[model samples]
Target: MTFASWQFAVFAAIVFGVYYLPPVRPFQVQLLVAASLFFYGYGQPELLPLLGIAVGGTYLFLVLALRDRRWLPVGIIFNLALLAFFKYKFLFFDPQAPALVDIAAIDFLLKLPLPIGISFFVFHNISLLVDLTRDKKAPLPSPTDVFLYIIFFPQLVAGPITRAGLFLPQIEPKRFSDVQLVEAAKWILIGFFFKLYVANNLNEMTSHMDFPFYETLQTQDRWLLVILYGYQIYADFFGYSAIAIGLGLLFGYRLPINFDLPYISASFSEFWTRWHISLSTWLRTYLYIPLGGNRCGKFRTYLNLIIVMGLGGLWHGVGPSYLIWGVMHGLLLAVERPFLKKFEGIKSAGFRALRIAAVFFCVTMLWIFFKLPNFDHALAYLAGMFRPSTNPNPTKLYYDLALLYSLPVILQHLHLNSFFERRLAAWEPYVYGALAALAYLEAGPATAFIYFQF
Candidate 1:
């Protein structure tokens, strides 16, 4: 269930209530593992076995890999196979067809809907195998611990992908007194505010950016919607990550921080470092370094960058638009590399501001590909951004509403919100209370978290 829903609220409350009882302390990991299974199964019961096989099989492979380092590559390949089969198989075969593979079991497997968290859990599996195996002397973890690590409910679906090295050692019986209630409250409150009051409201305005609907927008409105979408996506994802982090705190498990002020980044590489920090870190550690990273010659490094980014793009989906989006990002990173030191040498605020604007503009524009997955539609939307509107009737947008809803993200990125928060330190509780009220009262039409599609 969605974090924003009443059902989830009830579910979380029930789980939380039983989670910290004196009697339940010893069974914390087992309780959480069961709760996580229930949480995943609630929405897609049919995929429960798939989830089991994924975790169970990964655990089995982990056992083998630990005993024989030679099996490490085999374990990694097994997880990759699962990811590739679910993520890219549709590109080659249509499950909708009547009789492509007449075998009932194989057809059923093909027809099975993509599990919601396959991408994320698969990554967790790989991390488990790699991180644990690397030590060589680390003791084998219990099956229950492995299950909890892979399927931890907070970061399971759309993740601030916690690495195995970072997350595994944190497993222990937690005390109620140790809960960071204030910090958790702050995270949860800010997350809900962003998701409901900011992202959801902006989603209404940016809905016009969808494929056919975008064709009716005025020229300037196209650009405007792109900026709003950039904000909305940030709010949506940051909100989810924040909530996940906060929930992890409640459970005494700390997930990684997923975002910084990414929009203020003056370079594409800096932007990646700030945005989706966990995923970028994952790619850098597991993929880029393994591929030789920048240790090789410049040409090889550039090729490695492109390859990693292209695969990163394909990881989101098998769409051409995703590939183009990723490749373009890679190109930007490569193009900026040689000039980075020179750019850093400039100390002027105006020049820095200009660079930030340029980076933000490019990043926002690239989001067009994400907004419209169809290559032609993405190209059409980009084309419209530079041309005059030709539609006989253009969709109207409320500029006042747009500014009001987007003010938080803007102020946040500028660090103005921090200034105000410090200035009104004594009124902190009241300000957050007001935000909570406004989030509930002003929340817009509900939409699924965007990254859930992955």
Candidate 2:
């Protein structure tokens, strides 16, 4: 169930009540496992077996590898193969191939649904095995712990992608302090505001505009739409991460921060570092470092960055647009590295602001490829932004609505950067109350988070 839904609200409330009861507290881990499995299987019961196989197989393989060490590859391959079969099958194979008509089994396999959160869970399992193999001194978690780590409901879907080492220790029961409860409530309130009010409203505003009509808009209107989309996606994904982290805290598990004001980043490399912090860390640790990272020569390092990012993009979806998006960032990063080094000594505030603006503009433009389904449509939209249009002008109402909706988020970013330089702790309660009221008054509709499709 989506976080914005009444169903999830009821589910969370019931789970929270049961979890904190004195008698039920000791069996918290088992209770959470059962709750998580139900959460994952609520919409698709058929996929429950797949999750079981992944959890079971990974745990078993890790156990075997502890003795033989040779079983490590076997474990890794098994998980990766399962991931590829579900995620990449449609991209790599044709179900209707003439020769496959005689083989009903092959066609059926090709037509299977891509399991929800397959990418996330597979990465978690892989990290578990890799860490075990790398650190022989580390203790192996019991199968129950392994299952909980992979299926914890808060992060089971779109995730901050917790590591086994960081998350496992928190499985033990702990007292929930008032301070922790307040902090979790604060995050949940902010998350609801972002998703229900900001992202959902923006989605409704732009829902009518499709590729066919995009070329008919004036240049100014197109740019405005593009800017709105940039913030919409940011709010949607960041909102999900905020809720996940807040829920993790409620459960006494500290999940990592996923975002850090990415729009203000001064370079593409810095952008990656700030945005999706957990996934980027995973990619660096698991994929980049193993491929020699920057330890190799400059050329190899550039190649590694490209390959890693390209795969990272493909990880999001098996689409040409996604690949192009990755390649664009990789190329920009490669070019920005030497430029950043040469200008490292520039300390002017004006220069810094200019750099931030330049980076933001570039990133916003690149988001065209990320948003559009077709590569050609993205290119056409970019072209429309440059060439003058004789089409009808967008109404002043549209501009005003866009500005009103977007201003709050922009002010939030400024406040985060210490622009006001005022202490907000004393006003925290009122701030939360204001956010909640705004969300309640302005919420458009219950909508799935953008990252859920991934």
Candidate 3:
């Protein structure tokens, strides 16, 4: 169930109540495993078996690999193949080719609903296996811990993808202190505000501007829509991560932070470092470093960066737009390397602001590709955003609402960058309370997070 939905609220409440009870506390790991399985299977029960197979198979291969290190590739291939069958099968085999009945069989496979979080969990399993092989001194986890690590509900679906080493230790029993509980509550409150108030409202406000209709809007209005969408996605994804981290803390675990004021990043390299921190870290460790990250020559390093990012983009979805988006970022990053070295000594406030603005503009512009599935439609929207047209003017109400929803995030980034750090910290409770009230009053209809589709 979606975090914004009443169903998830009810589910979480019941789970937390049962979990904290004195008698039930000892079985916390088992209870959480059951709860997490239920959470994952709530909407699509049919996929539970597939998920079980992935988990069980990975665990089995890992066990075997411990015995005969040669089984490592077997384990990686098996997990990756499972992911490929569900996620990228369509990318390789077209369903509608006007062929014989054989093609119809492939079409049926294409029609099967994709299991949610396949991308995330597969990567988690791969990381676990790879880490085990790399660090032979590390002991193997029990089967139960392996299952829990792969299927923990908090970050299971859209992850700050956890590493086995990082999360396994937290499976032991623990009690939450009042201070910890308060901190967790604060994070949950802030997450709800971001998702319910800002992201949801902005999504509703811009929902009508799709494809052909989006291209028909005035240049200025389209630009506004693009900019608003950029924030909408940021709020939606960041909101999910915050909630996940908060929930982990409530249960005495600390999930990794995902976003760190990415919009204010002064370069594409810095942007990647700040945004999706966990996934970027995973890519660097599992993919980039293995491919000879920057340890190779300059040309190979550039190629590695592009390949890693391109694969990273494809990991989000099997679409041309995603590939283009990755390529764009990779090229920007490659171009920025020399410039970054040259500007390393220049740290003036004005120069930093200019650099931040330039990076933000480039990043936001590329988001058009990320938002639109059809390449031609993305191009048309960009065309409309740049060229002159006599479309109807957007209402002042629209402008005000968009600005209102977006301003808090901008201010949040400023605070994160230490613009008003002391003042914000002093007024923290009042600011949080105000945001909480606004969220309650202005919350739009419940919707799934944007990252859920990935």
Model 3 Cα displacement at 129 (Å)?
A: 0.6
lDDT of 1 by residue, 1-454 (tens): 9899998899899999999999999999999999999999997899999899989988998899888889889889989999999888888897678865879898888887888978999999999999999988777889999999999998999998888878889999999999999999899999999999999999999989887999999999998999999999999999999999999999999899999999999999999999999899999989999999999999989999999998899899989999989999999999999999999999999999999999999999999988888999999999998999988989999999999999999999999878978798899989899889989999989999998889
Q: Give the range of the ten consecutive residues with the poorest summed lDDT in model 2.
A: 415-424
- Model 2 Cα lDDT, one tens digit per residue, 74-115: 998999899888877766567566544457876765666788
**TM-score of each prediction:** 0.98, 0.94, 0.94
Worst 10 residues of 1 by lDDT: 94-103
Best by lDDT: 1
How many steric overlaps does candidate 3 have?
A: 0
Candidates 1 and 2 compared: the better one by lDDT is: 1
lDDT of 1: 0.92
Off by over 4 Å in 1: none
C-alpha RMSD (angstroms) for model 1? 1.0
Tell me which residue pairs clash in candidate 2. none
lDDT of 3 by residue, 201-270 (tens): 9997666457666745666777888888889999998999999988888777789999998998988899
Error of 2 at 260 (Å): 0.4
Error of 1 at 294 (Å): 0.4
